[model samples]
Target: MRLTPDEGDLTARAFARLDARLTRDTGRPVALALSGGGDSIALLRLATEWARARGRSVLALTVDHGLNPESGGWTAFAAEAARAAGADWCGLSWDGDKPQTGLTAAARAARHGLIAQAAREAGARVVLFAQTADDIAEADLMRSEGSTLGRVREWSPSPAWPQGRGLMLLRPLLGERRAVLRDWLAGQGADWIEDPANVDPKFGRSRARQALAGAAPPAPEEARALAGGRPTMDGEAMVNVRRDIGARALAAALVCVGGGATPPRGARLQALTARLRAGENFAATLCGARIEAAGDAVRVMREAGDLGRRGTAPQVLTPGVEAVWDGRFTFRAEHPGWSVEAARGRLASLSDADRTEINRLPAATRGAWPVLIRDGALAPVLAGEGVERRALVAERLRLALDETTHEDDLISATR
Candidate 1:
């Protein structure tokens, strides 16, 4: 269904609608990931209106991935569009020369990398993408080959930098039809440059875009409904989680397993067997540490990080490291090599309920406790007195393991 005109004043109104949907859960500044495309231009025109009305700022960003010679020109056009909209704007470039096996994936990686970095520099809270419902529909169809489970995420933060931490990488137009955006832009007499690569069959998203061109748009409410429920914690709680564990740590708990070494090729799948053994929503893909069900087993693989952060630094798996940011806290094994610290924490003894509650804590009341972890285990016992007594019993055993544990550590040794 086409979005109603009254629902939004201009294309920026569309952006306003989207921002409202996304920020309903996260109250932060919205950074538009602009590319001078029709959809993005439409959003820019409308976003500025919305931002002005609400007394907020809209950061216009364009990522120039030098895959095509035209990318430079596109970036310039995007800058002009941002200026016309009166938004604070920045343009960033990416050299696509770094050899990558997959062109589409690599370009996407590069694009997101530039935008995420720009958002960081601007200190913006959320990065908004002009992804339409058509994209969602294409992604929905692609789910057959693990595309559905792979691409469709309720929420995805920029893994490139923690700066985009808790910043929702949102598809504000996920429920809107592309034609509506096109029509809206046409109504405004706004012209946007089209990327020729979009027609190239080599790019997966291009293929999806082509398929979506011939399809109908989904209901905006339907698309919004897909995002799931409100978070248990507030902004502060989220900030704490990002601070203590870093976003990757909690992401690891949800997607990765404890292992000293990288798994062979798709080790993520193998670890996923544990999840599949328990039954979960993951699908088959070697995207990162997260694995999906394929046949009787799962595929295991290293998880992907933000392009800017990837291939530059070694992963840290330090135990007992805490990241405190924006009033929220998180604890995790920071050293990526081998962790012995997660074993030392007394918080591991807490009942699952207490752990869940702690993890669900709001950002406002994080206090000094800050959800501590060491190596790879929770340390509620050491952090506070509210921990379950049963956890204290396990604390003694964990402490002994921390003391006497070695490379050849045995579970039976503690017992």
Candidate 2:
């Protein structure tokens, strides 16, 4: 059924609300992702009229995920609706083969990709999504139910583009409820596509949506806070500054030992560790070697894994420094606790698979190992035939304990 011109009135109002929410300034185009669903169709209809009033036009994009067999038919319906609404409509399709993880995440990623592409093609700065308050509330529920705080903050600014990606994602109707959108659409005599999968229990979001259908609607302020709508500065600037400062400072603090193979320990490492914890000049990499910041000292070990275990070592560091085991212990420059020659020999003794495993790690993790570079050559501790690998491990553990205690002291000092 064709929507009459009279239906354009309600849509226009909805569009105005969306516009006011997304764009406070004028003379800019707004791109709408029209899904041929009740919410998006209503959005597109109103957006067109709203744009007309501002001497602009609506750029509508319909993404065909191809998940449903009837998606082609739906696409045609969406295009026609766009035409009726007087929007410059475009269609996008996805062509990726199915993955083992099923189609939901893939389809969402594809849909956003298409929307971004269409928005870019139209030269539109802001791409509007019809997500509503219910969506936010449901996500809130999901977060509250989960134990991991990591999952709650994963909705980062979209990385779809290098510069304008932030503009590519704006949920204008995010403050509205699904029922409100439906009511507004009904007033326009409009209908929308109802995907059966939306109600399927197997999908976590589907279940969440179903639960949301019965819950009391959220307050506007609560929704706004969850969506990060308070006053803010440039997040990109903050992140870049943090990463650069942290990385460089850490790099500078690292002390090379065992002919530049092993890292520093006791006081030298502790000083570096102090700066790292203070969020000051950090110059170390956690990806390669393990570093522990203790009271006024930092300890470095060449081997540490996710499970918090450090393997055997003579603890070779820089060319001039090495911690050697000989049933009796000593620090030497020429013999260097463990000789640079002995360290090189140990690395050569490793099997091909062990070498591959070590090499596969990132530079940060690999740097943490008890290996050192002597004149640009790989060097590792030979584990001093009779000296127990367990002794070196015990010393590393003690350093870690000291680091923890010092970290607590730093925190207490700050407080």
Stretches of candidate 2 above 4 Å error?
1-28, 147-159, 163-166, 220-415
- In the range 27-95, model 2's lDDT, one tens digit per residue, is 546788888887787677667776777677677889888778999989999999988989888888988
Tell me the lDDT of model 2 at 5: 52
Please estimate how well model 1 matches the true structure, expressed as its whole-model Cα lDDT.
0.48
Across 325-407, the per-residue lDDT of candidate 1 in tens digits comes to 11112334434433211211334576676666644532212222223333444333334322211111122112211222221
- On lDDT, the leading prediction is 2
Which parts of model 1 have CA positions greater than 4 angstroms off? 1-29, 145-149, 152-156, 159-163, 218-252, 256-415
Alpha-carbon deviation at 392 in model 2, angstroms = 46
